[model samples]
Target chain A: MSESNLMMHHYLAKYLRQERMPHIWCEGCGNGILLNCFLQAINELNVDLNKIVVVSGIGCIGRVSGYINVDSFHTTHGRAIAFATGVKLANPELEVVVISGDGDLFAIGGNHFIHAARRNVDIKVICANNFNYGMTGGQYGPTTPLDAWTTTTPYGNIEHPFNLAHLAAAAGAVYVARWTSLHVRRLKASIIKALQKEGFSFIEMISPCPEIFDRYNKMGTAVDVMKWFRLVSQVRHGCDPAKAEITENEILVGEFVDIEKPSYGRLLREMTSRVQDKLKREES
Target chain B: MVDESRAVLTGTHFMSGDLACAEGALAAGCQFFGGYPITPATEISERMSRRLVEVGGVFVQMEDEIGSIAAVIGASYAGKKAMTATSGPGFSLMQENIGLAVMTETPLVIVNIMRGGPSTGQPTMPGQQDVMQARWGSHGDYEIIALAPSSVQEMFNLTIECFNLAETYRVPVILLADEIIGHMWERVKIPPAEEINVVSRKKPKTPTAEYQPFKPDKDLVPPMACFGEGYRFHATGLTHDEKGAPETVSAEVQTELVKRLADKIRKNAEKIVKAQRVMLEDADVAVIAYGIPSRAALSAVREARKKGIKAGLLRLVTIWPFPQELVSDVAKQVKAIVVPEMNYGQLVREVERAAKTTPVILLSKLGEEPHRPSEIIEAMRRAVK
Candidate 1:
């Protein structure tokens, strides 16, 4: 198939709410590309659509949940992971996926992110790293590089950015990966793997916010940012996440960690059954 | 399905108000508890942690109060009856998601064991300070059901009632308990599960293809569908349409959504509001109080009656929706109303509004100790004069 034919025949239309489209993302924003990638991943996995819930926090990425044609939740700011945790625990049969932005996940909601990962809750968290708070007009976030310019950091962000892959791995996520929107095929594959993972899984997608982050900096447009990513990105499988931080010149992107652990719901069910058994034995 | 064997703890036991609250939740078919440990409210979570596990339920100690309420709302969406307990500061943290719960119309029970606070003023001490906050803590215009329990037994009874009310109205119900009632221990009788009235949210009877998630019936409450129940509907905190889709720039949608959210509870105030009127039929002065202060008010009313003073007690069981009609009715007949609250006259404003012509005297107490019966009697004497 030709590239145009492939783009025209993409399976994403069926996964989106027809009326809610044309989405609210800016013309050159990378959120649309990320959403397409996510839908593609879901299509490839062939997961039961009714059993899948997409939960999002307050951000530009958070709006994705509202647009998706699935059982979704657009929760309070920075609470997607916490809410997803509840959904997973309440019904282990459902697949809870959280798609939110860096500031929503790791800044105001940093505590919940780490704790959910620590508990190894059965949920997939996809963080769109746009270097700044895109929805709130490009404020400096936890993932904003030390010298990157944001609206909140006019003199350059003095604070250090979080190495999200390292944070998730250290916080006990069973699967962790990072990919840029420029690497759509690779990012979708990683999302598929994260979705199939048993325990808590996290994927950080380094996306471009051309309207805010790129404009504040001297980066040209969304196309320019994608070109920069393609130019600087290096695929490194099983790279130590601590050494896999994205700098101005280098973007290390690949699968960093995959392991097995009992998820929170599994352990909770085990404990509940054991307690019930004991009660039955005592009654007998 | 009331699982009598697993849920009911049918016996009289000496327990604190917090423990009774946990037991009440379990008896009311609450299967999930998401909470963080805070002063006074910690006992409730601790008890829930042990008891919920035994009852084949899930108990999660969340990182913070924000996460606690968020988890409760999530559990409710996934078709589990869930609750969380907190004190003043934690309740303040949960205000954001309380609005989320209101906007999404998720049924949840929140137990706010009130402490002295503007900001963690007295963690170990008691205060009825969050009365107004319970009604208006969250941003924007919305209504809530808050019940103030004055005794350990009432804590047990009201927690169950709060859950039932939450399920019935599809709104977050608050058990506006205080530190004193939470810590106070008393004998509580637990009825069998068969006898206990447990209300669950109505589920959608329509097929997935036809169901509209936010389409309310005549009672103004939409039937809920769980996440994995083949009901592929979206829920958002933003202003949404009947299909549960976010429709942010539409003024008509916003007006209809907000009005429905407030009116559901306001319209049902007659069924939601409950109060105990003691010696009110032939009294010139009425003592209007709730929570721990109401105990003092009851004593004062009895003492004033013995002293040949025409005083009565109007103890508030359902604090929110303000019981305006009942208060107005009492105010018209009575010469004066004395409101004795632990904080500096919070609920007295409501009484003053309700009792327009009659003087509503405020007996404000702002300390660790509750109001003494003498202090309330003195206020009643002043009101009668």
Candidate 2:
């Protein structure tokens, strides 16, 4: 939106793309931009890209692993979080990042995400919420806005879109934030903070899928779709659940939550030593 | 669960496939086992958890089969010979990550003591439905070295072989066992330490700086560096170049990656493939069998000898890499081949393919119950006549 933000976006895109895959995501898809923001965050944070593992589930956004030049994994649908958690717990030294689409993370693997966050695993999850199934022919998903027309829900969406940031915060995610693709700089900062935080951190990027979601919803252009994102979203920080409303053309996106706690890796080590101590006492 | 007696001892006793698998992992120098309990294979997780700790190793019960394999792969990447065991259902859950190991060329052992399935078909019962799935379970074209052991000893030896093959090749090896072997207890001897040849994955013999995780070496299997190791190499499930970074998902990368993956096993198939032949020096008919059915076939052949039918036996010690050429050559000399299996005509196709001029017959039973020696005898007599 600003000249500085455009330069920031341009700078972020430099080191993110693989030569073979200049662009695998559909045109007007925010996945590439989201990936750019992630790269900028990790780059700005000065992480060892060698030790940084960008894990993704199977989807358009999941292909982020394929483009990122890291020790990444393009895992099976909904299992990236589980795999990333294993990778994190296995070494505890590697910086693991799970970049998954809303459908990839929420619908099938929502349980794993919650449990992992609850345990405070030292990993950052950057979830791209396009509010519809952008891949697989624009089907209605868990994050599909209420009353949105989709291939599966032709008449209207009957299900409520999950307020993912709120849920992550509630589930013991030490740091949590939500931002639209429009605010790439803020999202980048949020990701950097989440990556730096030594516990379970979650960031939801309300991305636009102009080709699929926009066409299906009869929204004409990317600009209009972004406008809808701005209008529908309540900029309510400490955004109370009781005040949450379901209005057509309304969506919520901003830095929703942030905090800190002992990471799962830390607690696990503690548990291991405690057991070892107990065994020693009994033996003595 | 703590076998305070330690792993360095000679033992002969009845045990299921799971316990035998655990001991095999231990003897193979596996110090880490991460898995979850799934039927026909729960004993493996339980035993591995207990034994790994006693051996000053690590056993982590991950949340699911996916996590189980993930943890083991991570541990393997951490410079440990690691493993995880599960059954058909869990194996189904593991297919995706199995592909991850395939693409990453991660060295680990997975014991698939198969039960019936498309999904949760027969958790406790025995089945060989995973025969086709084991080879092509992961969505890719690569050579998977799966070994099927007929007896408890096969389970023990095959488990060790699985690890050795995995480490030597830097690829995941499957101990394709069954519920019967997994649950049955039989005498087994832990191999003497002096005789046991443990192969850790080939570390970079060159300067660590020149190491590429997915690059083919002289043997086609590239030396892999552990995670904590200073060598900086990236691993991805995506179609990767020699350096283990994601390359284009095109025909070229696919061709190169798939060829390398398949070639690694194909090049070493001779060294990896194992099987057994009995009474084939002068025989008219042969009993082609593996797994529990082979046990029956062994008995049937002994009875056929008493009857003077010239019925020999060809037992497939390695279920995968199929022992086809050997079977085919052996089959040409015989009049007919009797294939008695637990599943309905699963291995019969292989026998028929192997036996060109000879009659290739099938005696199959699809039941919760296993095959009887008499059933195989009846088939053998029919073939001989």
Candidate 3:
């Protein structure tokens, strides 16, 4: 399909709320691309639509949940993971995923993010790291690189940004990966893997915020950002996520962590059955 | 359905108020408890940790109170009856998410074991300070049902009522138990599971294709659709339309939605509000009180009657919808209304408003102990004068 035709009449249109279309995302914003990738992954897996739930917190990407044609929840700021934790544990039969932005996941909601990953809750989390708070007019956030310019940081940000891949792996997520919007096919592949993973899975998508982040940082435009990602991105599978960092010159992107452990829901179910059995034995 | 043998603890047993509250929740078919431990309220978390496991339910010790309430709302959305227990400090942390629960019309219960506090004032003592906070702590205009349990037995009974009210109205109900009631051990009769009244949230009877998650019925509460039920509906904290879609810029949508949220409880106040009026028929003065302080008010009323003072007691079982008519009725029949509260004064302000022209004297106590019967009797004497 031609690029224009693909953009105009995507096959995944059925997965979106058509009535709510002509989405409010900015013309050059990467949220639409990231959401398209997510829906593509969901479609490829052919997972029961009724069995999947999308949860998001406040941010530009937070609106992703509302646009999706599924049982979705747009929760309070920075609480998507915590809310998804409840949903997954209550009904382990349902597949829960949280799609939110860097600020909403790591700044205001940083504690919940680390704890949910630590518990290895059976939920998938996809963080759209546009380096700044795009929804709120480009404020520098936890993922914004040191010395990066943003609306809030007119003089450039002095605070160190978080290496999200390192943080997720350190917090005990069973699967961790990173891909830019330029790597759409690869990102969708990683998402499919993350969705099927048994424990807390995290994917950090280095998205483009051309209208704000690019404008403030003198990074040209949305097309320029994609070209920059293609030139500087390195594919390294099974590398130490701690060593994988996004610097001004280069961005390391690939699957960083993949291992297995019993998820919180599975552990909880096991413990409950054990306790119930013991009680039954005592009564018998 | 509850596992009667495991969850009901059906025989009469001596237990603390917090333990009884946990049992009441289990009997009410509360399958999920997400909580953070705090003083006075910790026993509820500890007890549920054990009981929920035995009953094959989920009990999670969340990282913080904010997460605890957030998880409770999530679990409730997934078709589980869910609750969280915390004290003053933790309850303060939960206010924002409580507002989210209100906006989404999620059914869940929050058990706030009252402690003295503007911020962490007293953790190990009793105070009715959060009664006002429970009604207004969350930001924005909304109404909630809050119950004050005076005794250990009421702690059990009222927790169940909190769940019922929560499910009935699709709102977060607060069981405002104080430190004294939570810690005290007393005889609590446990009825069989079959005898206990449990109400679940109304589920959408409409087909998945036609269901609008926020479309309200005549009672002004929309039927809920759980996540995996094929409804494929959306829920948001923003001011939303009947389709559960955000309408942030629409004043018409905001007014219609917020008004319905408040009026559901206001319109149904008669069914939700509960109070115990003691010898109020021929009273010259009335003592309006709730929670642990109401015990002293009861004793004071009895002593006042013996001393030939026609004083009566109006013990507030439900605090949020503030039994305005009941207080107004008593105020008209009485010379004055005396309000004894653990904090300097919280609910007294409500009584003052309710008792329009009648003088309402405030007997404010601070720190550990509640007002003594003698102290309340003195207030009653002043009221009569």
Candidate 4:
């Protein structure tokens, strides 16, 4: 590629760690598309890059933290949300975001996810729901669809999958949305909305794990999976997230919940100020 | 920044060891506390929840010990002095993230108020069983500083020391208290803020463009750069080079990084290690102990001296990077060493390792009550024989 063509095509180059580029994502993996959408969202917002800290847990999507140019942390498996909570609560001025995988966010880290959402911490969570544990060779995970074939589930996945949108909404996320990797523009728009929200916001990006999960489940090639996403996707704004489940025939996509309340950091600051004022009055 | 006046609690007061530990953290300028409620350590969290507010700090009661430690590490990386308190079971849950803190070189403190446990063997009782786990709990080759406080005063003083060691070395420091000291109410003198010694993590002096997050100075410890510092650096649990990018496949990177993580504490063990030597100047028998058992060991040493047995005490204040030189020196002079622990013999193994040819007697006690002075004195008598 010529320098001019490279400059034109890789406009989001500034948002990535160029030295670490040619990421670890497999060929035809949707992780790149998801990353592109996220970077585009960040680019469109034009926020101070210094203030953003991206944290990720263990998985293919977890590598996103390492690839991002900002101050990032690739934390332990299933701990991105918990770690992000600490970061956001410690310094409210820093915009803490967690980008991790389904197994990381739900299976091993399920309790932390719910509790962080329940506390309404002011952090954005972007979960790349590739449906199985992609990094660990497509073992079945918490979000693995029932009857889906995986490494651990040779015959079929018997475990019930979590409807992540419903889980986020039920666990008290102030903003919730879901989009497949095929919906690039809409996903980018939704990411921007989630980023702008003041309280806990969650956006589930249904990505394709072509080399591992799709291969085991016979979902054809990565492009074929993208076509499958297009065939089944339906946009529903402000619908009850409880009704938004990903079945073979239909995958509910779009903004399902958006509301506002005092975030954990805001309430903590309020309480601290109130207590400090009380102490002052007592001393005086 | 904390208002120094509100933080110190600056006076003599009667309080439990757990409360004193919390107050000590406040005095040390700890601005973030993430913890879970567990036996013998719950009071620390309760006190932190109330006091962290007055000092304008953040206190979060996480869902579990794993989340608590993870949050503590997160808060530390965001440039706050952070800590969490738990007992054995919770400490076990915290091991993985504790290792994460070690690899990422995040500074934090963990106070484990130990209870009897292979698995919840005792809850309302004291034990020194977690000492070995504190050293090797996380599955990796890294060194951590563990301080054992024997009294309410030491609980307060050593909790502050935990923070200082953690910040200065950029490693997780464990305050190994036990049920006896945690719940025991006693007088604690909180010194004025200016008189107190507090250490903060060293920040990078180099320009942002030239910064390498894991590049150490002559001290073998790197200057930390927190999130939102405009450094735009990245850190991970995976073995990485000086640049802090993940380099899992490189044998040299793994060797260099892991060795530094251990050597940062090992090379500076002399400065980090602390212990109280009592009457060991001319003694035939030496008693080695820590935490609650150290108090009994002290009493036993005095009792043995009264009986003309020439017994003395080597009370370990810093339990990890195991203080081998101190034990070896004492072992050479003494005829025999007596190790009385609350568990089925944890640190006794360390004493034996350090004692070399010197006979090391293990007086292992298991129960709700600590070893009686007579029991330890009896062991001292047998050791001298």
Top-DockQ structure, candidate number: 4
Candidate 2 is graded, for docking, as: acceptable
Q: For every model in order, what is the iRMS?
A: 1.8, 3.9, 1.4, 0.9
Shift of residue B90 alpha carbon in model 2, Å: 2.8
Instruction: Return the TM-score for each candidate structure.
Output: 0.97, 0.87, 0.98, 0.98
TM-score of 1: 0.97
Judge the docking of candidate 3 as incorrect, acceptable, medium or high.
medium
Q: What range of 10 consecutive residues in model 2 chain B has the weakest lDDT sum? A: B1-10
Give the chain B TM-score achieved by candidate 3: 0.98
**Cα miss at A8, model 3 (Å)?**
10
Instruction: Put down candidate 1 lDDT per residue, B239-335, tens digits, no spaces.
Output: 9999988888999999999999999999999999999999999999999989999998999899999999999999999989899999999999999
- Across B1-385, the per-residue lDDT of candidate 4 in tens digits comes to 3665788988999999999999999989899999988998999999999999888899999999999999999999999999999999999999999999999999999999999888877899888899889999999899999999999999999999999999999999999998999999999999999999999999999999789999998899999999999999999999889998889798999999999999999999999999999999998899999989888898889988889999989999999989999999999999999888888989999999999999998888887888899999888887777
Q: For model 3, which pairs clash?
A: none
TM-score of chain B of each: 0.98, 0.95, 0.98, 0.99
Which residue runs does candidate 1 get wrong by more than 4 Å?
A1-10, B1-4
Error of 1 at B79 (Å): 0.5
Cα displacement (angstroms), candidate 4, residue A106, comes to 0.5
Off by over 4 Å in 2: A1-21, A25-29, A169-172, A215-235, A240-263, A274-284, B1-14, B31-34, B53-67, B70-80, B117-119, B192-194, B205-212, B226-240, B243-249
CAPRI-style class, candidate 1: medium
In candidate 4 chain B, what residue range of length 10 has the lowest lDDT sum? B1-10
Clashing pairs for model 1 are none
Q: What C-alpha lDDT, on a 0 to 100 scale, does residue A231 get in candidate 3?
A: 94
